[model samples]
Structure formats: structure tokens, C-alpha cells
Target: MSEETAARRQRPRTLRQRLQHFMRVRFWRMDIAADAWIAPTASLDRNWPRGIHVGENCVIDEWAIVLSHDYTRGLYRDTVIGPRSVIGTRAIVMPGVRIGADCRVEPGTVVSRDLVDGEHVAGHPARKVGSS
Candidate 1:
């Protein structure tokens, strides 16, 4: 592992962080990394909790929705958010989408397709706006 990553693992967690981790891991059964920060209001797919995979150092901001299942379409697929990425506030990640590392999803954007590494996207249908 990198020195920075090793150092991060050694840091102690606060009570709130521990509680959140417990709820996310034990209760929700999501594959969120130890150092990832998920906002209290972030909505990970509850119906298919095992399908949501969040990588190390990811930040899922408030009201962001990492949706892994679409009941209307009878779809259930994994939604992967790569490491060192940020899902902006209220961003909606569609089912089966694989977001790449170092990407930034702008707020209120609806991501319906896979993202390449270091890509930044915005808009309702999620067009590529830039790269990291």
C-alpha cells in the first residue's frame, strides 16, 4: 500500500464515524471502503445493498443516490464508484454504472452510463464535461 494509505488506516475513528461504519457495513451490507466518507443523507440502494461498491477515499456527498436496482425495469446490477472520487450532492448514479477513479460527478447529475478514469460529467443524461 502507499504510505498515505497506510497512515490513513492507522488513524482512530470518532464515535460518530464508528457508528456510521457499523450501520453501513453491518446493517446495510454495502461494500464501502474503510476510509470512504458517506454523508448521513446519502442514499445507497437498499433493495440491492450488496450491489453497491464504493472504493477507498470516496466521498458520497449529501443526498447523493447510488442506485443499484431499478424496480421499474426489473434491473439489478452492481454500481461501482472508484477510489478517490466524489459524487456531488444529489447526484444520481443509475444501476449497473461503473464510475472510474478520480472522477467527479457534478451535483444533480444523472449518470446513466459507464465513466472512464478521471472523467468529470454533468447534466441530466450525464455528458462528459471534463477530466480530473
Candidate 2:
């Protein structure tokens, strides 16, 4: 990482900011980049929060859901949202899914599998619609 970027990351989180991300970053042990934006209404899998990773500059919009576990199958797997990606409003990302860097997941879409870098996906099972 660039020196400036590293320094920015090292900067302390303000009380308000800490409170906003407390559930995922502190109590849940999720790996969310300092610059990532997770909307207040977004839902993350509390069952396996440690398995969820949100990369730098990623945005998880309102009502988006990112899962790291499936209680029905008793599975706990890592789910990754790569750098600069955007999880659109109300989207659902299934367990163990890895969304690559710079990708875009459209609103209300359900992602059940991995995505390559720069892909733009939409629909129930997240079909590729475009790419960056």
C-alpha cells in the first residue's frame, strides 16, 4: 500500500464512526477496511462475522446482506468483498462468495457464487451484465 494510504488507515476512528461500525468491526470481528462504507441498514452475518471481509473503498448500500455462514447446512466459510466494489441496495451475497475487485452487484440481486475482478452482476443468481 502507498505510504499515504497506510497512514490514513492508521488514523484513529472517531467515536461516532466507531459506534457506526462497532457491530461488524469490533464485536463481530469482521475485516472491513477503514475506508469502506457499510450502510446503517445493511445486514451482515453475525453468526460468522469473522469470515466476512470487506476491502478498501467498498460500499455496501442500504439493506444489503453479506453472509459468511449458512445455518441450515452448518457451514461457516469466508465471504470476501474485494477493493472498490459496490454491493447495491437490498442485495444478498451468499456464504463463501468472493466478489472480486472493482465489481458491482446490482440492487436486489442475490449472489451465490464467486465473481471475477471488474465484473458487474445482476439477477437472482448474479449473472454477469458488464464489467469495469
Candidate 3:
């Protein structure tokens, strides 16, 4: 393995350490369990609520924000991304949005609504661009 990869693996684990690691790094937390793969640059904010579940073979791209709370109202909810879905780069998934299986959310889309299975959505408000 490369030196940087090896060094990161060897780093010690602690509560403070994990917090610092989460803040400093731009990836899924080590404790986050996923059957899918997440890209290194994908960021999940520290203030994000719990119960973030990603299904099998999902791809969350860089700079995509998946939120589990409505910060303006202080409401907590779960954000579910179904299996084989692709959340494009810089997409903003709002609180309580349930994305269905095999859906493709285009880049820069702000998804605040639940998507049906095998749908393709795009744009700021996120409409159905195509059917899969």
C-alpha cells in the first residue's frame, strides 16, 4: 500500500480522535456501515442527524450533501438512499427524502421530495427528468 494509506490505517482510534478525523477528512465515517461504496470526497456534515442508511452498491459522489434534519425547524428525520442508486456530485438531498432503488439524481440537483423507483431527476427543485 502507499505510505499515506498505510499511515491513515495505523492511526489510533478515540472519541476525540474520531471527531477530529471526521472534521478533517472528507469521506464516510469509519463507523458508518454501508453495503455500498462511497467516494473519498463525499462529505457528510457533523451536525447531520443519525440513521443515515445507504443500500447495496449505491454511489454517493463528491460534495453531495445528504441531510437528515430540517435545520430551520429543528425536525429530525431519516434519509434513505436505496440500492444501486447514484447520487450525483454536489446534489443536495433534503431532510426526510426517500430515494428509491436504481434512481439517478443528477448533479447539482436539490432533492426535497421522495423519488419513485427507477426514476431520473435533475434541477434545483428536482423534477423527474426521465424514467428508467
TM-score of each: 0.86, 0.86, 0.72
Model 2 Cα shift for residue 98 (angstroms): 0.5
lDDT computed for candidate 1: 0.87
lDDT comparing candidate 3 with the true structure: 0.71
Q: Which candidate, 1 or 3, has the higher lDDT?
A: 1
Those runs of model 2 whose alpha carbons end farther than 4 Å from true positions after fitting are 1-17
lDDT of 1 by residue, 1-132 (tens): 234434444556668777877887899898989888777778888899999999998877789999999999999999999998888899999999999998889999999999999999999999999897
Q: Ten residues in a row with the worst lDDT in model 1? A: 1-10
The C-alpha stretches of model 3 lying farther than 4 A from their native spots are 1-33
Query: What is the per-residue lDDT of model 3 for residues 1-132, given as tens digits with 9 covering 90 to 100?
Result: 224323433444546545534543435432343334454666655565354666766767668887877778987777888877888889998878899988889899999999989999999899998976
lDDT by candidate, in order shown: 0.87, 0.85, 0.71
Candidate with maximal lDDT: 1
Ranking by lDDT: 1, 2, 3
Q: Pairs clashing in candidate 2?
A: none
| RMSD, every candidate, angstroms | 4.2, 5.3, 8.0
Q: What is the TM-score (0 to 1) of candidate 1? A: 0.86
